[model samples]
Target: MKEHKTTPTQEKVLEGMDKVYENLIEFKKKANSDLVVMENGKIIRIKPSTL
Candidate 1:
């Protein structure tokens, strides 16, 4: 097996994703409805029940 190294940019992006996941977990605990977000001018909805 070989070792792998994460680049600085990849590290930053992973950190950001971790934060977003944490926030979503917290939001799910306190939210009773679905969450909506706009991506590329399109509205995407995520159901809290699925989370």
Candidate 2:
């Protein structure tokens, strides 16, 4: 089987996604932040508030 190595940029992008998912899983209603999500390495706008 052939394996494809991940680039640093791609790894960073995946890491950010993991962080967001983990935060959501451990999330509490009282804890939230003004987080901005990036689209293709560019910040589009601030994300909506979490529950």
Candidate 3:
């Protein structure tokens, strides 16, 4: 298998995405809300506390 290198811009984008995801989870947990997602063509609601 070949290895792929990520550029600096790619790294920054990934880091930003991670931060946004973390914030979303924190907000949901604090508000006692479920995180809505789609899996296997079905919509699912998961509690952040479960994370």
Candidate 4:
């Protein structure tokens, strides 16, 4: 495999990932729940018990 370096865009993407993780923590705190449901990076369902 070839070694690759992150470009500016790749670095930005990494930053976005960090933000997403942080936001997920916030979501869990404010919702007081861990029943997060997502599809394609967007919330499609929440508090789902019947599936």
Candidate 5:
């Protein structure tokens, strides 16, 4: 099987996502409520339980 590696941009994005995930976890613990985020110009609410 061929091995694949992440490019610099992909690595950067992954790192950012990791930070976001951590922040979300903390936010959920403190806020005890759903998270609100804007995606594709639409406002979406994500339940902490769903995460």
Candidate 6:
């Protein structure tokens, strides 16, 4: 197994991305909206409740 190293700035960016993702999920749930994403080269819509 190999270990990956990230710079401090990279770590902060990754953390920010995670927070944004969490907020997006929360927004979707509250808005009763579907999350659109790509899977196996296909576009799909998933209900937030499914999460």
In model 2, what are the clashing residue pairs, if there are any? none
Give the Cα-based TM-score of candidate 5 against the true structure: 0.61
Candidate whose lDDT is highest = 6
Order of models, best lDDT first: 6, 3, 5, 1, 4, 2
Clashing pairs in 6: none
lDDT of 5 by residue, 1-51 (tens): 999998999999999999999997888968879888999999998887777
Question: What is the full ranking by TM-score, best candidate first?
Answer: 6, 3, 5, 1, 4, 2
lDDT of 2 by residue, 1-51 (tens): 999999999999999999997776455333544455689989864433542
TM-score of 1: 0.58
Candidate 4: the clashing residue pairs are none
- Superposed by TM-score, candidate 4 places the C-alpha of residue 47 at a distance from the truth, in angstroms, of 14
Q: What residue pairs are clashing in model 1? A: none
Q: RMSD of candidate 4 to the true fold?
A: 5.8
Error at 36, model 6, angstroms = 0.2
Task: Give the Cα error of residue 50 in candidate 1, in Å.
Answer: 14
lDDT comparing candidate 3 with the true structure: 0.95
- lDDT value for candidate 2? 0.68
| lDDT scores in order | 0.86, 0.68, 0.95, 0.73, 0.89, 0.96
TM-score of each: 0.58, 0.48, 0.86, 0.57, 0.61, 0.88
**True-structure lDDT of candidate 6:** 0.96
Error of 2 at 14 (Å): 1.0
Q: For each candidate in turn, give its C-alpha RMSD to the true structure in angstroms.
A: 5.1, 6.7, 1.1, 5.8, 4.5, 1.5
Best of the two (2, 6) by lDDT: 6
lDDT of 1 by residue, 1-51 (tens): 999999999999999999998898778758767778899999998777767
Per-residue lDDT of model 6, residues 1-51, tens digit only: 999999999999999999999999999999999999999999999998897
